[model samples]
Target: MGTWLRRVLLGGLLITQGAVQAAEVTFDDIQPILQARCVMCHAGEAAPLGLRLTRLDELLKGSKGRPVVNAGDPAGSELVRRLKGISQPRMPMTGPPFLSDAEIALFEDWIAGGLKAGRNPPDTPVAPAPLQRPAAGQPVTYAHVAPIFASRCVKCHSAYGLMGSAPEGLLLNSYAAILDRHERVRVVPGAAGASELVRRIRGQSQPQMPYDGPPFLSDEEIQLIVDWIDQGARDTNGQPAPSPVGARVRLQGVLGEGWTLDSLPLVVGPGTRIDKAPEVGDYVEVRGRWGQDGRVLVERIRRR
Candidate 1:
């Protein structure tokens, strides 16, 4: 081979190796970057766009009840927007939020690679099970609740992980630990009104949990969690608890599958939707009432 051709071929080989590195955006690469530059404010009570760059699950969950990284759509992902300095006040606010060329390339590669979530590779495998709900009125178990905490809270509170270092020694690493410290300064069960966790998410208290504002928790999610805790906070097989008042809604007629009354007052039927008590002909339901114009209310739907 000619000398010049040999040089060109070697350069092409190096370029290929670089491409492989770019394709490997793992937790190790993304986590520390977020924890150091983003998590302090974004983890809880201080996020800008409700985007929590905290945990892998939270990252996948994304903003506005949607995934920020839509797999191969890097241009559509908010991560790209913030990183590209496209939005006002470029991220890392103070110091240069500069990502190395390699880092940026890695992110692009990750996006192209399905934006795959969880720990990387087969060695540190992540469970592929989809999100599941525990049976209502059951005692809270480690398996079920861990995923919740891991998804929602542990992002900032756990050490040896991304998000912030343990804030004031509040360790959410285990169920025993969380319960042991439940009533101290934060976890106030049976009283969502007084619980710091509830208060923080509701934005009624300062220094909000999740560190991100407004978009942190949906009104429905916050209420469900609070109600769960208020119901003596039971797990997989406890006695039934009283259903929440004013927040209940009944379903009627043959509805689509995968729909539930977890969040009441959800719009149903065609054209119009209402959460509160609806009048007759309005096609609404409040605690077992199915009528429009708020006149008569019907009981919960019975299956054939």
Candidate 2:
């Protein structure tokens, strides 16, 4: 074989190897990059343009209009375009400390690699049983709504909690606290549609509630809150309204960073139980209370 032909063949082999290695870039490799640079705005209901970067599924599902990352096609991916400034309005909307070239390259490689989801630790637990809804005809009041806030709104809004500063001075930790805050009337008795709480959760308002989501509250959960507000937003025994229990989220995706499933953080503790060692791409079920930090404090996990 000619020396020149051998050099070309060797170069091709190196290129193929690089592609194969790039394909291995999974959620784990890219999650920190996202958490540090993207989640600030991309998290929660208020995420601009409804784009959520907290999970792979959210990225795949895209904004209310379209997908952000196009698997196996970094050049065509909106995420890539934004990072490279090929698209109008470059990302990290808060940048001067924009993603480094190396960081952006990681994302490019991840997309090129087919966007492999990351794996979980061996001891990662399975999902728990579904949350049971409150019995029919229960009065919607603080008793019912508090749990929702406990699991979903307190991490950021609580007077003292972790997961960064609360936005807009809003606090959802207790009944009196929420009702007493007149800075912005979040709930108006007998008017679900008029309530800022309802509007935010329903995406009628700019940015949404829960602030971190593509997995916004389920329809039933939203209805429960609406019913509570529509019935006069009382503490209890005022009137019957829908009351949903803690949410039980079951998803299939590679675990990434801490106890995250598909980019959604999971807070596991003494109450959490693990059945078997779970790996990346292993479908698992997680049952727990969704926290204000947008994490699930998993009580149980079932690997299938």
Candidate 3:
């Protein structure tokens, strides 16, 4: 009887230990939450405050000055404080729809259990699924290419991307924007080999794009983009290319405030004419088109 009771007690203890181990949060558990909620404002070079949440090393390294996460002490961690709003500017910096309570609790639990970085998480989000290539012989147009960009590139390349500033001032929002640049050409009609877009994705260029990778562009997706560029990278209508729009816009803040026109991101090109230096809240008329990278490339501007 004594031996049987001891055996039963041991079995109960083993089960309890397994339960405790299962309950402890690791980086893997909270990674999806970070990718979905945090990395948008905390990846790459344009990351605000130099805080990068994309990798465990970056998270552990914290922002420019101090650590964001404090292991074994959720109350003392800046990341936890920011999420809880005990710190200034409740995080995501672009929110009212902040991280859910359950999500925040996960971080709290992870930290309290001793922050373990765990293994790396998958690079892309789970939803919307991976894109399949369009049927063969279908004219590869913006339609075919947009999904590829939306899925892989736009997170870091769009105007509103978390990188704060899109790399190389590029914005991949529309075809007109994509083709209107004066800087190094991203795409050359009928020549995929010459297109920087193709080279980067194919890993021929320095710093192969989609910046986060190992799971790079699938061959079918790469072929689609190459085919589109080879086919002149046209809009769906294939009509004469649209010209940049001209507008009279008010400046909300100083040029140093980062250029904007009517709340849309703007870029001042060398060709842009400024009759007078505009100050914050000043009104000006400008002619420009959306660059391929999705910013308004100002060609001409004058006080209105």
Q: Give the clash count for each candidate.
A: 28, 20, 6
Q: Where in model 1 is the C-alpha error above 4 Å?
A: 1-131, 134-145, 182-185, 235-304
**Cα-based lDDT at residue 76, candidate 2:** 96
lDDT of 3 by residue, 1-304 (tens): 6999999999999999999998989888988777665675576775656888777777878999899988899999999999988986576443344678999999999999988767655343323333444466556667556656755676666666658667988766556556654654566565565455776787755467789786898888899888777776766554323322332222222232466544546688677777777755665554554455545567766655
Candidate 2 global CA lDDT score: 0.65
- If ranked by lDDT, best first, what sequence of candidates would result? 3, 2, 1
Top candidate (TM-score): 3
Per-residue CA lDDT of model 1 for 1-304, tens digit only, reads: 9999999999999999999866566566565566544554455443445666656666776775566677888877767666776753344432232556666666666787676654554233223233344666555433443444555565556653344467766666554445443224344344444344565676644455666344486665566667656655544344433323322222332222333222222333443333454333333222232224322133433332
Q: Per-residue lDDT tens digits of candidate 2, residues 34-137?
A: 76556645666755568777666777788887888888999999999998889855655434336789889999988998887779542222221232345788
Model 3 poorest ten-residue lDDT run: 247-256
Per-model TM-score, in order, reads 0.34, 0.36, 0.45
lDDT of model 2, residue 214: 68
Worst 10 residues of 2 by lDDT: 122-131
Model 2 alpha-carbon drift over 4 Å, by segment: 1-134, 236-304
